[model samples]
Target: MSAADFLPRSSLSSLIDLLQQQGYRVVGPQVIDGAILYRPLQQADQLPAGIEQIQQPGQYRLIRTQGPRLFSWANGPQALKPLTFAPRETLWRSHLQADGSLRFEEVIETTEPTAVLGVRGCDLAALSLQDQHFSGDPYYQQRRDSLLLIAVDCSHPADTCFCASTGDGPDARAGYDLALVELDDGYRIRAGSPKGQSLMDNLPLDAATPEQQQQTDEQHQKACQQQRHLPAFEPSRLIHQGQHPIWDSLAEACLSCGNCTSVCPSCFCFSESEVPELDGTTSGHQRQWDSCFSEGHSYIHGHRFRPDTKSRYRQWLTHKFGSWVEQYGRSGCTGCGRCISWCPVGIDPLEALTELGREDVE
Candidate 1:
């Protein structure tokens, strides 16, 4: 617990200006479609002010706050994944050559540099996992390399959140350049990298007092205590539990709509498409986010491995909690609980795990 620096609430907007001066498109939360959405933030006023989200399993609502608070909600539907790993992207395009040959070129987007403000600890953990998954992906690198991360601590954890159990956050622990804890009147900022240090040096900030630092720590502890959590289960259990009847129960209630994967910050399954012109001389290839629950995902040359809803659900659960550890040396889930909140059936993955792990499940 090093002494932190304080940034007055009013001067917070100046930090946005500093990032903008460095040619970074500052993105933060905004009220959109009756909920908070992360988008390009131009001014501080554009932040979701005087509003907070009340979230539970399969339910989300907004409430007018008694006071001014920019980021009171735990999360929106979107996470850092969409910002780095595109939902749909043109990977490459091939054209018919003049000499009856073909040529191919990669399609990498050259967009403005981005500074993600208000990143959560769980999302940061998810990004690190994705970095390993997409290490060789040029498009992902293109979006990730020039970006700066400024994480805001969750002072108010949602009922659906479980970052404490996941050890990812009630506050940012790693992978962020700068981490901020919001107070009633200002923010207590800490540096996690050289870029954060450099940015810290130039900002119009004051040294934080011991009382302010204590307040930040208290709020962080309170958030961890408030958020819901999952029962502890070893990663290896998920591998053996694949054949359990719990998967069948999950399938019965499951819609297989792929909503869980889309909302999960760490899910990285994708499918590619190729289109040809009428002349069949030129072709276009693109990639999009895919879910294991999708029927086509299990298809290979007209044979589907997990055709049934039960098997498909099993695949997603196993990959996320079991085989993922073997493949990547880490569990894929960060415990942000977006899956539970966004799932149409309100089917919580933890409940499935608990059911499958029971002594009688086998």
Candidate 2:
């Protein structure tokens, strides 16, 4: 309901273990290949404890510091979407016997109540956008029912990030069970949901001091000031620019490699394949992440839809920034800038949108 503070880093590990004891799998940022990745963390020390990442076009690396603060790093190479919507899974399985008896089995649903520790604000917004697409729809309730989110403030942001302009963050606003703003010595923890309240009720914590509250406020203000500071565009106005020539021009440099969509925290498109046995009597279906940019993704009635790279690129950006709100009632881009940083051709979405804005003025 409100915020609290904890002084002990050792207790933080205990808290994680306590959550694990309560059957919640603790998911937090860990170091992998010089990048921060969301994975199961057994102790607070296992987290990229005091490491931050420096990111730029075609560059990403980690730098270490003294202290046990989390959220020290910037966003990672992979987005958060695949955590719930797994990139690869079996949809269902089929079996056929020699007697020609056919049977189909639906996969059993299994979910570990996940505690997402140190989720970045941009990722939180991406989850919000995904909620509209999945949880907002009645069909996706099953998946939404399983996650427990714990978001952390962005003490540091990369050069390419523009989430602040999008009203999503340098700090998380909603859709978290608990929100943490890290301090040099401790954490100012805010409970964002009843689930968090229940957990904190058992923990040894006290009401935040006025000074601690001020630190939280000041930390957020500083983070807001340090953003990439890209120009703002209203989400509602995105659609009106669909016919603008900026899409075609930007497509020229796009490799149509789908690198942007793949690394985006909100992109959820996928494809299905049938794994048939040698006897051809049985097969199981496998689901894998797919993108609109792939050539084989367009087969329809023996013909490809949106065959050209220009059209494919246009379709992706248009849906992500322009029409996604109408289609899913949310902004597709989370302002994560993974797309901008990870794109093979280094095409910047904000720059592209700004160019379109310039055309409107001209």
Candidate 3:
């Protein structure tokens, strides 16, 4: 840890200017279409100031507040996943040549160096998982290397959040260039990387006072006292529950709409296909984000392994909480609770897992 600096709320614009001057595209949370979305930000005013996100099972609402804080809310539906692992991208294109020889060209997207602000701790952990999964992938590496992560300690966690239990969040710990703790009139900022330190050097910042550091600690503690939690269960135990009846019960409520996976910061499933031109002159091979809940996800060799909603739901839960540990040394979930809040039918995975854990004990 390094000595922290204080930047008054008014000096936020100066930080943005510095990023732009360094030839980086600045993106941050903005109020758009009734939600806070990450978009290109040219100025500090574009941040969702005086706004708080109220989230619960199956519901998310934005409430206008009198507070001047910019990053008070816990999180939004999207995370750092979309920035590095693109939802839809062309891998390569094959063109028919005049001499009948095929020409295959890899499609590597050219991206501008970007700095994203207002990142939460859970998302930062999720991004680490993504980096591990996409290791050696050129497309993912290109975007990953070009990103500058600016994280904010979550002050007001939604009721659905359980990052405290997962040991991933509420306070920005690691994986960010810069971390911010929002105060009433300013922010307590610290650099986690050399790039962030360089930026801090350029900013006209004051040494963080003891009182401001105390305030930041209190906010982190408040966020940790959230309502939801993943149950105490061995991750490997879920692998044996394939035949459990809970799948059928969950299937009754699970729309299999894949909303949970979409909003989940760590869900990395994607499908690839080839698209041919009508004239057969050229074809493109592209990949897009996919979910285990989808029927086609289990389709292979003219047969679908997970034909019913029960099987599909079982696969998702088992893999996310069980087998993921074997592959990644941790559960797939970062405990951000996006899945619980975004599910249209309010299927809480934490509660479901608790039930399963109880069943195992019984």
Candidate 4:
């Protein structure tokens, strides 16, 4: 359990075949629309092999690299959250019977055995947070229970990534079934759970050498060193600065479009509604992802609590970094940096939070 071994890169196809044979639909990063996105695949060849990514604040692009290396990209704007916690899903349905009686049918989510490959450690961290966030939610639980997490160490890091500062990544300690450190010749594989142990046992591999472990260590350290250094400011510290003028500056740069929340790995807010047939007989309840940045998200009985853009933006940043700890026993942001790349204006949460520590901010 402590040591790892090498899996010949050529035998990777066997792993995919094995997963497929076990009736698992493998979902992982693949090039789409000039960027990498998680998509289902039937073969290893379909994966974004030979692809590399370029990510920066408010920008993302994918380029073809020289060799056949899968999972060269760090991540796009998504994580495992969407695969388990769907963006839009029907909760249940009700229909009026011919005798005027009503019958309600529960919409149970189908659990397709899935294998999610190339999951980065930061995302594994986010998935852990979301697992706690949806503890008793049946829809989420069913889908999550069926996933086989194959986590890849973040050997390649983006400028926006700061998982090391959050104490969350570059490598994984928990939440993964299997963990991998990719090398040019093959991969160093370690089993994190019984499921992972079984898979590795079945695979053709050789005992790992000390040099391989050295390479893994070097790559991990290099990833940790690549993060854009963020100023140290505890999330709880922001709760006292309710009247800070940083809110106004954030509001100006923010479009209130809610792109950041949508792309975030840990944000789990949603709104529900009832939809009825035009004849008024059958109806279904639905839930869709919601953002606090929306104008109507804060509306109460007859008034919107946070009507202004500044108030909404403040709510989001504070909730993500500040109050989320009180709610979940940990900070909400995993430092994945999707919010920076996906935001239309590239609003960096790291910069915003650090600025709140300044004395000039009222």
Best by TM-score: 3
TM-score of 3: 0.97
User: Which structure among the candidates has the greatest lDDT?
Assistant: 3
- Which pairs clash (backbone N, Cα, C closer than 3 Å) in model 2? none
Better of 2 and 4 by lDDT: 4
Residue-level lDDT of model 3, residues 7-68, one tens digit each, is 98899899999999999999999988888889999999889889998898899999999999
Q: What TM-score, computed on C-alpha atoms, does each candidate reach?
A: 0.96, 0.90, 0.97, 0.96
lDDT of 2 by residue, 73-152 (tens): 66897656777677787777899977889899876466667777888778888877777666643323555677788777
Q: Model 2, residue 225: displacement in angstroms?
A: 1.3
Clash pairs (backbone) in predicted model 3? none
**Poorly placed runs, candidate 3 (over 4 Å):** 1-4
lDDT of 4 by residue, 281-359 (tens): 9999999999999988998998999998998988898898889899888888877888988888888878877888663
- Candidate 1 lDDT trough over 10 residues, lowest sum: 353-362
Candidate 3, residue 126: Cα displacement in angstroms equals 0.5
156 Cα displacement, candidate 3 (Å): 0.7
User: What is the C-alpha lDDT profile of model 1 across 1-362, one tens digit per residue?
Assistant: 34448999999998999999988889988888888778889999898777887787788888878767777878888999988999999888899888988899888989678899989999999999999999988899988987899999988788889889878988999999999898888988889999989888888888888788789878988998998777657677777766677877888999999998999999998999997778878788989999998989989888999888899888898889888999888888887888888888888898887776674344
Count clashing residue pairs in model 3: 0
What's the TM for model 1? 0.96
